[model samples]
Target chain A: MNLRILIDRFACRFSAFLSVCCVALLALIAVGLIYKSWPILLEHSLSELLFSTIWSPMKGKFGFLSFIISTFQITIFSLLIAFPICLLSATYLVELAPRSILKIVLPLIDILAGVPSVIYGIWGVLMIVPCIRDHIAPFFGYTTSGYCILTGSLVLAIMVVPVMMHLLIQVLQAVPHELRDSTLSLGATHWQMIKLVVWRKCLPGIMATTILGISKAIGETIAVLMVVGNVVQIPKNLFESGYPLPALIANNYGEMLSIPQYDAALMFAALILLAVILFFNMASAYILKRVTKSIT
Target chain B: MMKHKYFKKLEEQFFFGLMQLATVTILFGLLFILFTILWKGIPNLSWEMISQKPQGGFYMGGGGGILNAICGSLLLGLGSTILGLLLSIPIVIWLNIYAGQYSRNAVMVRTALDMLWGIPSIVFGAFGFIIMLALGIKASLLAGIVTLTLLILPIMVRGMDEVIKTIPKELHESTLSLGATRWEMATRVILRKALPGIVTATLLGFGRAIGDAAAVMFTAGFTDNIPQKLTDPVASLPLSIFFQLGSPFEIVRGRAYAAALVLTIIILVISFLSRLITAKYQKHSR
Candidate 1:
């Protein structure tokens, strides 16, 4: 009995130690990224690094304008594609679908969410990319290969739908049933009640879902890399090929060691990626806080 | 009155139709993907494909199989899942057991984890690469495992925390009133209560770790052979699909689908099983 007690005491301390490590790891990563990126920041002015548009790492000219723009362009375009579909489906799940249907449909969505990104990339390569190249791009009069901004955005939209829809479903489910009941009692139709009551009530959360979806879209690496033609330029139109931030880092990080300051520059790009994701997440958190406050 | 009623019914029907269409699209997309992967992948799959490492010229109508990637992915996934659990379980316990439910510290930690969960896998990969350079560690299984551990830690912590949160406060108090230490109460009561959830958390982390290509792409260098040591470079199933799909040969492209089919089926099974486990435990808790 004494030995068992002693073992428990040791286990407690060990667990506490591990818990502390969990908190420390985040700080360690931040410090390491900043430390690695310092050299690039030192060599170039902030505007020059962020806005110069020319990203010839061979010539030591590092500008992230094109990539950053591409990232936003792809993200925004994908969100535009996903927003209505996700919103409507989420509303359907919460308001229209019977419990029996939901039990099956919800699990299917969950299963889709767990599919790996690489699998999506493979699907994009085999199916979506060709459809874009052969059918869609030709209609748009895109003369070159089918890899372009539109292809990446379309693929990304498909990937983000499950995530955004799941979040929206949660937000919609959180709406007080009393609100819907009261609205319906006031001679409002079911559709009218959902639009004026549930939708209005959860607007902040809905907005936050958009931000969260954008964060996911921006951070997507493999699927974006496979379809986005990876040209280091700001695309002229939706049909033109361009590189996004994550794809750039993945494509070139391996060969970074061979060039001067290239590794540091890539680290800087990563830091930018990290910062954008963090910024969006913080914004979403802030919005969610307001949402709960408004509900109460 | 009749005209207004007709318009109202039409509006409702239109919106409902749109919502149903959206749901159908999502379901159809998922089925199509499954069909395509299985259709393309199953023909290329064989015992020889799964059991033997690739011979030379594997990408060019090759003679060898992807045994190396299969073993390496398992090693990395299992290694990272175990490591992530070591950190995640305690952190979850700290959040739910040690800290009071509504404490400020608990809220802060949860917020940080939410942000971490939102951070992209690519950034984690970059951070791992930086750490590797600092430690003079090359791209190897150890680096991949460490990076993957970090990648999945927040996810496991959050998943287990939610499970722990579902336990009633009365249970904690009753255990404490029995003169048991917090550690004993946690180990004896809470963990037992949350066992199914904890298993689900571990499996979820494992799925994420195994499926991720970006987090391990740089840290775990691809190799044709199975890793014999922690420091050896290793190939992963995701990267194998990636490389194979990028090949010029149609036959190799078929192999990519084969790998994707295997990966997707594994992930699907994990999701289904975890749901089953969670349901089983929910019955007990109720």
Candidate 2:
């Protein structure tokens, strides 16, 4: 019995140590990236690095203004496109769809979410890019090479819909049946109850979901990189080619490290990406915590 | 009043109609993507493509197949999934068993994992590359597996954590009351109850590991032959498709679609298997 207790104590300590290691891993990543990027950080002021647009690496200038703008433009536009559709789809699933439809649609969403990002990249290259070039762009009185910010946004919007809709459905379903019934008993129509009660209750959750989606979108590399044309410019319109931070790192890191500070500039970009995503994730977590607390 | 009521009813109907349309539109987009891949890929996806490795000048529309990439991807996926599982299970066991479920340490760990999950796979790749540089290691299969393991660890941990949280509290109490030590209870009872969930989480990590390209792009240098040792360079299906689709040759582009079809089928099979496992094991749980 004593031996068994001893073994249990040892296991407990070992597992606790492992858990501590898991937490430490995050700090380690942050520190490693900072240390690697320190050289570039020392050479340039943070404001200049963020705001300047001249990106001639061989000449030793690394302005990141264009990449930052493009990242924001693509991410915000995609979220604008995906949020409403996800909200509407979740409402339909929770309030209107029959059990049989739910059974099918839920699994479909999971499969869609599971589809690889690179496959989405392939599909975007083959379908969305061409469709935009031949049809959508022409209809809007502009001609594009089928690779632009709009193409990236459209593909990303689709890529994010399944995950966002899945979460929204869960949030909507968590509304108490009694709350819905009470609203209906007051003679409000179905949509009215949804607008007044259900939507109101899920507002924090929806906000959190949107923030999470933004984090996901900004960090996506291969799919957006494949379609965004990789031009070093701030896009003036949806049809214009642009570059984002993740794309910049993925496209140029290995081949160009021979240039002085090139590796450090790339590492700095990675650091910025890491910091932005961490902020958004923490914000979402805070919102979600409030959501659970108020519910209980 | 009658006119106002009529207007409100019309508004409700209008918005409801829009909801249905949005749902249909999303579903149609998914089906259209699958259809496009099948239509373009099926004719080119031959038996030889899966069985034979790429031959000379393959990117220039040469003969042979992507057997190297297929095997390499499978090997990397399996390696990383096993490594991730070994790390994740202990972290989760500590979270649910040693630390109370709502303890401060548990919350801190969850937040760290959540932040880690939001970091892009590309960032993971970059960080892995940094580590390799520090250690004076070249891009190899081992490097790829390490990076992929970091990329998928949070996913597996959170997934398994959710599953273990669902196990009834009474079960935990009963196991301890039967004189089972904490270690014995964890391995013999809780682990048994959560076996199906653990498998699903493992497969989820495997799917992500195999499908990811950016995380392995720099860490796993592309090669024509499968690696005979951990230190050797490796190829993967996503990178294979990326390189092939980038080719100007139409034949190579066709092969990209074919390779994509293979990747998609693998993911679909995993999702289907996980569902089946969940249904089968749910009856055994409380």
Model 2 alpha-carbon drift over 4 Å, by segment: none
The residue-by-residue lDDT of candidate 2 on B1-286, one tens digit each, is 9999999999999999999998998899888888888887899899988899999999899998999999999989999999998899889999999998889999999889989989999999999999999998999999999999999999999999999999899999999999999889889999888999999999989999999999999899899998999999999999998889889999999899999999999989999999899888877654
lDDT of 1 by residue, A1-296 (tens): 68767866776677666666656776777788889989999999998998989888888899999999999999999999899989998899889999888788777877788889888887777788889889987886777577889889988998998888888998899988888888888999889888888899889989999999999999999999999899988999998898999998999877899999998898899899988998999999999998777757
Q: Which ranges in model 1 have alpha carbons more than 4 Å from their true place? A: A1-17
- In the range A38-64, model 2's lDDT, one tens digit per residue, is 999999999999999999999989999
**Between which residue pairs do clashes occur in model 2?**
none
Note the DockQ of each predicted structure.
Answer: 0.68, 0.85
Q: To one decimal, what is the Cα RMSD in angstroms of model 2 from the true structure?
A: 1.0
Q: Pick by lDDT: which candidate is best?
A: 2
Model 2, position A163: C-alpha lDDT score? 85
> Where does the lowest 10-residue lDDT sum fall in candidate 1 chain A?
A15-24
TM-score of each: 0.97, 0.99
Candidate 1 chain B has its poorest 10 consecutive residues by lDDT at: B93-102
What lDDT is reached at residue A52 by model 2? 97
